[model samples]
Target: MKKVHLGLDVGGTASRWVACDPDGQVVARGSVDGATAHVFNPAERQRLGTALAQMAAALVAEDLVAVGMVGGLTGFGSAAAAEIAALAKEALGLAPAQLLLTDDIVLAFAAQFQPGEGHLISAGTGSIGVHVAADGKMTRVGGRGILIDDAGSGSWIALRALDAIYRVLDRTGSLAEVQRLAGALFALVGGSEWHHVRQYVYGGDRGRIGALAVGVAQAAEAGDATALQILAEAGAELARLAQALQTRAGDRPIALIGGVLNLHGSIGTEIQNRLPGTPISQPNSDTALAAARLQASGEEHAWRAILASMLTPPVPSLGSSVSAAAP
Candidate 1:
């Protein structure tokens, strides 16, 4: 039996595992809830560890090669990816085996164009644009969520939707579409009044806004003007992030990932037009593999040197136009 490689992707709501054979073909897989959370107490950690261990055990074989993580940043902060990578290795009981892991965003980037030219704008519940130069040097250009600076993101859009409702309540105007989604969100969280939201406003519960984002998008898809506008603005901000990167990085290939940017018609199209460039496609392998390759390269000692190498050969290119894999 040959050892396989495992790739774990922890999104805001779920964690998934992708097992790969020696030839890099994805074979077995597993996932579970409780993978997405902003802050975790001991209970959360235990749940997470159990989920990971169970997934690994279920998918592992004598042929399994290594295990890597693409998400699960948690409270790790700036070193989120690296921290989660190591933590996942230990949690999976694969510490001594070869493990390749990194952030979900990195995986998204690589999924498009590894070591390729251009900027990538990812807008799901969160938003960020990353630029990996032909020179292997990866620079984070955007990705400050709403708390700090996410101008266009699911959170921003959801808040806007809520604001639209507030405006309607004030008799300012009617955001007809928001009525449904906002009500749905409040209902899900057991809050039926504005006071409930007000009391929890600054308490750091991200589930409400994060989850409401999907509803907003749904309304927009169903032809809600306010929802469309919100997404349009979000798309614009996402575009700006790409523009900023392109302006700074000499016109690299720009790849769009995340559900927000991929929204149909007006929003996504508008974004592409605003940020002019030939769109580079997504690749077959996940971007985590790209980041894993980077990690395997041991570029931590000299990131600049590693980036310079990317410039020399193996340019990034995507073979596909679009993919539905959510970030």
Candidate 2:
């Protein structure tokens, strides 16, 4: 039987997995619905298990036999670690020794820098900055999830835009006078009515709300001042995360990861402008692949080197204006 190792990167917005052979070659890769690591929540626990089962089914379809697995789960907490592990073992058919689980952000940090090497700023559905020290201790800033902070995160940006839109509506009594951002939000929410917006914001999860950032980015690209300002503020918020980590991270370079950073050029530009002279790099390596390698080798440098080898050349930076129609 051909042996394979599996790696999973589970987040609020999506879950990605990769299967790798002993030689570190990717054999199969796929994505399933997003799931949180909050196993204490019955709903979240079910979602995590379902996503794992779906991944298992995909592996079975490809005739892959997983020898071991590593997973980085969002919202992972020590209190729920055992429960999360149990769910993974039951869904993936793995033994206790065959599994390793960690926070998704930790895996992201490892993918880019070795412990004590750099700080990582991750802005996806939520945002956080983290640094792993030489002694394996971790220091974090601003990863409190959408309910609290997550300042520069996708959800934060979406909320800011929504707040602005509603404020305008309250004053004008009509969205007709509102510009590109209002239209973009209206189209995304499926209508301009208060009920439509409320339903979309309240009825859905954080991922759904965070997705509104896409429309916000589109509006900003169309020169909507509100959208532009929100994105700039987002960048500044992310910079603050990095700055906060500096007390412990100590002059380390910053690695920017996550979908929010990719939403618009303005976000990155603002980060750079706010934190002048700080070395900031955006590494595009696949975290799932890195996780797979870690499962296979059990050594940090081994997986890091393998992932580095697979890095694609960087694409040119996006211009100030992203191409998309408002709404």
Candidate 3:
């Protein structure tokens, strides 16, 4: 019988999995509602665990054991890796020795970079920049969360847009621009008044507020100066993040990941212009494959060996959009 391998990538917006048999062919693939370990509410945390359990049960069939498994999840750290492993062991029927858990950034980085020096800036509901050194050292910047950091992320952009809407209302007092631009944005959110936007924002969770960035992006594309400026500033902030990582880790190619950056968007152009001589490449595989390629030994070649067996290229990320996946 062929051994089964499993890879899971969980983010704030969605979770995805890919399973491969010993023959190196994909046997099972699926997605589910987002589950991250960053929640503070007890009920929300329980929901996350339940979501993980459901995903695991759906992927692995009866009378079959998962020989090995790896998971790259949001808010995962040394402190939480063990807990995640325990969860997986119970939920997936895997032994402790057969599982590995790590931060989603690791999977995102590995998806685009190889066993060398490279930098990655990922923006989504949250943002983080990572630098993997030639000596196998890892350095990270940002990704602290919405309240304190994540400068270039969707939440950050949404907050900025909200601030702009307030500023325009306070400064302009029904100017034509406000009625034409900011008012239109408000309407898109189903709010006839600013207080309605406030109610909608406060009524939902962080992901709901973060989803407002989509309206901002749409406004920018429609030639809203304020929206355009907001996106430009976002690009500038992300470039600064890239520059910070490159300065410490030495100049290297940068990979951009996440949903906020459209292929034809100004953010990519801004990053390229700011970081001269540094190449920016897209990930060849999705985060699930990257996590699945992780080896028990945690060596560079071990990962490379797994990657070399891939029969197909990576699919796009599950949470790579402005709106969070509906639960």
Candidate 4:
């Protein structure tokens, strides 16, 4: 009987799982809504937890003997890892040693590079940088939760855009550029009224709010100075993250991952220029694929070699467009 291993990437926007045999052959794959232990809304947190538990329960095979599972989950920290581990074991009937939970950034980093040295700057609803040393010790930067930190993240860009919109509404800024960008932002948010924007801002979850950055990116493409500044600043902040990691983890190829970078626009180019290397590019695989590779090998150094066989070769390095609506 072939041994089965499970890999999971649980994120704020979506979650993915893969079950594979020892040869790294995927036997089953599934996905569901995102899961997060860290969220402003408790109900949202519970919903995430339920989604994770249900996904795990549905994927686990009862007949498998002592299955191994590696989960790279967003918003999962030391405090919550044990609980999440417990939930997985309870739902899947696995033992303690069989389940391992780690920061999703680590999985991303592992996926992007081989056993050697490298850094990762990932932005989604939030942002973080992880540096894996040649010796495999990991150093983390700027995953301090969304409220205070997460500079250069999607939420950060969206918040800045919203601030500009409010400043325009209040006539707080005299610059015509600011006003023009603010109007664009207002229309981007919904365009009904200030009250509507306010409601959307306050009531929306982090993922929803972060998504607004896409509009900001679009506005920048269309020659909006404010939006350009925001993307430039975001790129700079992400560069700072890479620099900080480099200071400790040594200079290495830095992989940029996130929707912002995926847009492959000024923001992405800015990140590549900000970093201290050649050929700045996206990660070879997403978090879920990384998680699957990790579970299949259980070797910290096997990510690149294992995944190379499974994933398609990354697209040749290339470059976003300007649009009223964000894609």
Q: CA lDDT, every prediction?
A: 0.57, 0.83, 0.70, 0.69
The sequence of per-residue lDDT tens digits that candidate 2 reaches over residues 89-156 is 88877886677677788888878888789999989888888887766656778877687789999999
Number of colliding residue pairs in each model: 19, 0, 1, 0
Better of 2 and 3 by TM-score: 2
- Ten-residue region with minimum lDDT total, candidate 4: 318-327
The number of the candidate with the highest TM-score is: 2
- Candidate 1's C-alpha runs over 4 A off are 34-48, 60-86, 171-192, 196-204, 262-264, 280-327
Query: Model 2's lDDT to the true fold?
Result: 0.83
Tell me the tens digit of each residue's lDDT in model 1 across 154-270: 677777777777777678545353666566446644585777767555554454465566767776776666777777887778778777777766677677766555554566776
Candidate 3 regions exceeding 4 Å error are: 38-41, 60-64, 295-327
What would the per-residue lDDT of candidate 3 be over residues 210-288, giving only the tens digit for each residue? Answer: 7878878877777888878878888888998899887877888888888878622887778878988888875544778
Name every residue pair that clashes in candidate 3: 285-314
For model 3, where is the 10-residue window of minimal lDDT? Answer: 304-313
TM-score of 2: 0.89
True lDDT of residue 77, candidate 4: 53
- Model 1 RMSD, rounded to 1 decimal: 8.0
lDDT of 2 at 279: 93
| Model 4 Cα lDDT, one tens digit per residue, 1-327 | 335787878777788887777777777777877776553457755766687676665664443433777777765555565666666666666775676666577677767776455677888778888765554555678867567778889888989888776676567544465655665566667864768778888888788788888778767767888888888888888888888877876777777888767542677767777764545667556566556656777773344343232222234444432111001
lDDT of 4 at 272: 70
In model 4, the runs with Cα more than 4 Å from the true position are 1-3, 38-45, 57-66, 172-180, 276-279, 300-327
